[model samples]
Target: MLASFRERFSMLAAVLALGVLVGSPDARAETLVIAGDPWCPVNCEADSQRPGIFVELARDIFGEAGIQVEYRVVNWARALHDARKGRIDAVIGAARNDAPDFLFTVTPVSHSRMCFFTRSNSRWRFTAVSDLGGQRLGAVKDYSYGSVLDAYLLSHAEDPTRVQLAHGDRAFALNVDKLLNQRIDVVMANAWVMENWLREQGLGGQLRNVGCRTPDLPIYLAFSPALASSPAHVELFEAGLRRYRADGRLQRLLQRYGVSEP
Candidate 1:
């Protein structure tokens, strides 16, 4: 009976070893799906080699922990909706006001300086929310510029003459086109995002940032509130982020994308 028991234990060990060597399905890396609009420098084209800062950071951090990240480009509004329903795992470049219910990392990945842009030849300036009146303001739909601006935009949403809201992943680009064509007086945009767009499109001198809203806000990598794994995922990301920040890897990564740490 002792010899028989020993033989059974040896057989069980061999089977377990075979399972590991053969790549058992149970041991495969967990995959997290992150989706958002093409908010470049934050998150960019999904198929691009360099994708975006947050996307790459998630991949790097999760990849090191036996996890895989898949990024997808979708309209911001839909991305938020899907994340809420658990169709998508996470959203990047999200402001707190953008999705208050979503789980957010304690550490901010970057900051957004909301600025108003106008044609280089135009003289319109944005000094206050009141200044936005009498001017056809261009903005993206479902985006939170700030508390004051958000209130203003909400109030003027139905008034096309007061505000022209663009939708979809290319909303920012469309707004810029409107500004350049004299269709809109001023367009609200993120300073860093505008800088990246102008640089990429070679339209550097075509427009100028007249003024910016005060109190720049931090953006984050937010996860679906409906996902059971969200808590663990956020914890993992937070730990990895702290390590990267402490080691200067975060700063270097930002620099590579021509972005300054916020």
Candidate 2:
């Protein structure tokens, strides 16, 4: 009886030791939380099977290194704020000027040219800053439209006739609604993002890009500056991005989203 009890105890201890050696399934994979507004083809719907290009890229790259990406949709301002406070991992589809304090990968994931959109028949085209004098401009809050436009927007922000900023995760869509309803004369957004949006919504015939004055700016997968792991995350992204570029995965992914390579 004593010998049988000793054998059973040894077997139980061995099983427990093996379990400790293996660890829990949850312990095997690290979770990375990323959040941003829905800037389609860049980062789209949350909990979607086809979350945007960057979201997929992050999952693909980080998954190889035992990391899982959790994407969420938050308003741009909140996303930026959370990232700054170390409450999140990264913010997708950000221009450097958009969050200069955030940590960034060495290479840009894409490029953006901010442009003004008008009704297909509107004679108002943005030729100079003077052209903005009489037009009501609709823009997403917390977005940077470069120095010249930013300055103009700041000076006129209080006047509804001059500038109206949309807030919320769906701010871009709201701006589009305002434009289509003639509540605003012009809408400002990234040229490629807006083009994709119009094409996807079948509203291309309703709106047209008047002009783009701001230089094409590089966009990044900006990581939290406050996180201790941010630097490593940035490095991982930089290396993986280089590999993707070399292997043509980047081009293929961009094609899937109907976007050109940066």
Candidate 3:
């Protein structure tokens, strides 16, 4: 009986080894699906004329690994939702802690500074958080400014009416149009994005930066919890990222996409 058990175990081990050699689903065809918003300059875009820096970096890294990568451009809300559901493998170029459902990678590839924008002629000067009190402010929907800003706003719950959220383009347009129509007081956004949008919309001359939150926020590539469970893939990605950073390739890629070092 013991001899028979040993034979069965040996056969099982052989079968497993054969499976690995044959490239079974568990070992073969490692495909990673990444999602991001194209509207944001650093992440995603529909226009082939101008691709995002983060997308380019990811493509190069995965290409080196001989892994297949699929990128999907979706609205910010849908991207976050799908990431939470594990319907997507990863979310690229997201602000750390932007969503509670996803786990962030330890290394951040880029950073963005949050700033307040207003009409050049506006009287409001944003020196502190209190300046936002009793004033309508525009911000991208579902984007976290940071913990300090979030906590400050939450602690002053009585000023709920002071905050107003809008989608990215809409929020930016609102700021422009508000200043034109005298509707809102200020609009908050990442400095790069705000500048890009302003220039794209031909409204750069009409806006001015009032003040900005200190300590620029870093953006990270976030993975769904499902993907995080696979330690192998995580290590692979980190290794690839480290290689890119070490060779100055990462910085060059960012510069190619108009992302200056912050």
Candidate 4:
């Protein structure tokens, strides 16, 4: 009976040791928790074989630095909020404008030109922000398009009679329906995202891009201050991104996803 008890105690100790080795926080050192909107072609859900154009690029770049990645798909607002609160390690494919609290990298993970779309028959010719007065616009709830557009959204939308702006969770997809039903007159979104969505929804050529040819928004994988390893991680990621760009791997990846270089 004494011998049997000793053997059982030894087995229990070994199992506990193994559990510590497996469950230690240090074991997850190089793993990053990333979250974002699953904007197709721009950034897709994790289950997707290729993910999305920028999602794969970020994975490869960070992987080059020996980091493993886990992604969560959520609304843009929530993604930014969680990153700000340090519930996650980083925000994927985000701009500094999107999350001012997060630290951004000099290396951009992806590129996207912002544009506005209008129905073909609508007479909304956009030469300037003043022209947008009196027209209804569809915009994503938490999106920061650009300085000019953001200013207009903040200042002009106060009076619904002047420049009425409608907000939605899935702004691009919802805007398509709104435009068809005349619920909104314009949609402000990424050029590529909107184009892909329009094609998928079988509304190609139905809307015209009539906004300013704004410069592309260079997206970066920004880190949350709540993360203890943020500074070191951001440095490693920037180095990895530089190497990725130098090797021309980014171009090949974009081509695979039918995305163009900006």
Task: Pick the TM-score winner.
Answer: 1
lDDT of 4 by residue, 59-120 (tens): 77556444578888877778888877878888777777877778887878777688778999
Residue lDDT tens for model 3, 9-50 = 543443344335437623325566787765456754545655
**TM-score of candidate 1 against the unseen true structure:** 0.88
Pairs of residues at least 3 apart in sequence or in different chains that clash in candidate 4: 134-162
Candidate 3 error regions (>4 Å): 1-30, 152-161, 168-180, 228-230
What's model 2's lDDT at 38? 90
Residue 246 in candidate 1, Cα distance off native in Å? 1.0
For model 3, state the Cα shift of residue 250 in Å. 1.3
List TM-scores for all candidates, in order.
Answer: 0.88, 0.86, 0.79, 0.83
Residue 199 lDDT (model 4): 80
lDDT of 2 by residue, 1-262 (tens): 6754653454344334323434643322557889899988788888788799999999887775566889999999999999999999999888887899999988998787778899999998997778998999999888877778889988999999999999997899999999999999999888767888998898879998898875677888999999766766776677677778867999999988887853
lDDT of 1 by residue, 1-262 (tens): 6754653454344334433544663323467899988888888889998899999999997776566899999999999999999998899888999999999989888788999998899888888888877999999998988788989999999998999999997898899999899898999988888999999999989999999998988898999999766776776677677778877999999999988954
Q: lDDT of all predictions, in order shown?
A: 0.84, 0.83, 0.67, 0.71
Off by over 4 Å in 2: 1-28
| Winner on lDDT (1 vs 2) | 1
Q: 71, model 4: CA deviation in Å?
A: 1.2
Q: Order the candidate numbers by TM-score, best to worst.
A: 1, 2, 4, 3
Best by lDDT: 1
